[model samples]
Target: MPPASHDGDRDDDDGGSFIDMESFYASSGVSFVMVLLTIASVLYINPYWRRVWFYYVRITITSCYYFVVDHLPVPVKYKVLELRV
Candidate 1:
């Protein structure tokens, strides 16, 4: 592609010099896939890091569960506690 001419002869109706939407989305999708693959490969190669990652995930989920349970209304809490038994 020739360098975009700075000469003021370009038509204003052409919508100017912008990236193609389809190409932009395709590139973005490929980039995200590459990033996920890299992360998966790293985790697969390092068992200790994978375990640590899962540990953090478990802790985060447990914390969120307790937080939600603790904030429940008294009647709801009673029902939940009864269900636990």
Candidate 2:
């Protein structure tokens, strides 16, 4: 590709950088297929890994919730508890 003109105006000679979606998708189809296959394998091929992943996600969320609650000011914590009661 020729160097861009010093001025901001585009030269008529250049076809411009328009993307052809059909060609782009054709080229990228293999990557898309690979990704889908990977996702399907992880979700269906190995049930044990799926269970472990969910378990870790649940534990991570629960721990973060506890950490936030535990770090609250004592007075605020007491107020929250009183409100709950």
Best model per TM-score: 1
lDDT (0-100) at residue 54 of candidate 1?
92
lDDT string for model 2 (1-85, tens) is: 9988676575553445477666788879988999989977887878998898789989999999999989866665457444553
User: Which digits, one per residue and each the tens of the lDDT, describe model 1 over residues 9-60?
Assistant: 7555445648766778999999999999998999999999999999999999
Summing lDDT over every window of 10 consecutive residues in candidate 2, give the lowest-scoring window: 76-85
* Per-model TM values vs. the true structure: 0.60, 0.43
| Candidate 1, pairs of clashing residues | none
